[model samples]
Target: MSTDCTTSSASTLTRRSLVLGIPLVAAACVSPGGGPAGPWRAMSYAEMYGPVVEGQYRIPAIDTTTINPAFLRSEVSWTGPEAAGTIVVDPKARYAYLVQPGGKALRYGVGVGREGFAWNGNARVGAKREWPKWFPPKEMIEREPRLEPYREGMDPGIQNPLGARALYLYEGQKDTLYRLHGTNEPKSIGTAASSGCIRLFNQDIIDLYARVEMNAPVVVRA
Candidate 1:
């Protein structure tokens, strides 16, 4: 899918103002005599991926042992023009970021569309759903006959591909039929293995669902 400050009290305050941009811009905002601001504190993998009862379902905990530590959720310095609250997906890098103020972002590892199934450009979060129904596209059903059964739709559950949450992407009035959703397959994070949508860890999606608002802009890089 798609998707500053100065110095002095007046000048100093401006200097310390958090600006979102490439590393160079962020570097210039360094505090006077102070190094970079204190590092962002993120939750431990255990807590971040722990099993929790969400709604009517109990989401299972992720086994971080098999996942790369780098792919885990953390605060990162972002170098992009998107404003705060935007969702940016880097398919090649297998990462999805929620842009934060002050040249920083909340980064999460993601599984993107595989090969030819990948898509790019901009879209907006048109709708949000929890434990959403899964309706396999006709094309997908043709590719995997087994999915034909879901052509009508699949009820929400732990085994559902949409996992704990889904954010439907749209282009103005048109539905892109692409989503930023959760998956039970933690191992898929950081890989190009989806049909076209972006997938995150179940827990991560739950967290993202809560933070994102309606009509949030999304950018999926080529």
Candidate 2:
């Protein structure tokens, strides 16, 4: 099971709240560089809602082996000095860069934490997991009682929150609950969704999962 979905429709912050009765998977990602910037337009409902059953999404099987090539996108940055081999996640733009040896970098779209959940500073990828199991902390379980039933482990399936892969965040040797994971809810990308975890597209996660090794540095910023 994933996170709670108890919020009334009124509490939803989506731009397409007007279009009810259908699962949100049909919405589309707002195309950038448009005439006038307004509320985001989802590229399709599949971006968030996926395939719907009677009313809910019938999520598809997650292909852990194949990375979706569509997610390799780039956004602008201040273009600062490359401190040798380092990865930088520009919080404002919601993009992360894997610094290359020359002046180039491979950029990826990311979903950051909203407002109070935003984090910064230096850390590293302590370890990695393919179809990693999720265990919410004690406080999270307390706040959302529905999470209690999933304490043991969630199977690596389409509905799994970790998506295709997970890069565990850490400081020194301590694990920060925050993770860099792929999301079934692709619309959540380029926006904040969770307390502090960074979400990515399934294809993007699988790509990074293959490139990144243990103890890879990760720098987040405001």
**Candidate 1 error regions (>4 Å):** 1-42
User: What global local distance difference test value does model 1 have?
Assistant: 0.71
Total backbone collisions for each predicted model: 16, 15
Q: What is the total number of backbone clashes in candidate 1?
A: 16
User: Evaluated with TM-score, which candidate comes out highest?
Assistant: 1
lDDT for each residue of candidate 1 in 1-222, tens digit (9 for 90 to 100): 111000012211111122111122232122211112323233345555656664468777787888997787767787899998899999988899888777878788898888778889899999999888888877777667877677788788878888878999989978888899988677888988888889988877776776787999999898
Q: What C-alpha lDDT, on a 0 to 100 scale, does residue 137 get in candidate 2?
A: 72
lDDT by candidate, in order shown: 0.71, 0.58
* Model 2 residue 150 CA deviation in Å: 0.8
Local error of candidate 2 at residue 15 (angstroms): 34
Q: What tens-digit string does per-residue lDDT give for candidate 2 at 34-87?
A: 101122233332333223221232335233224333443432233557542356
Q: Give TM-scores for every candidate, taking all chains together and pairing residue i with residue i.
A: 0.81, 0.66
Report the Cα lDDT for residue 93, model 2: 77
lDDT of 1 at 135: 85
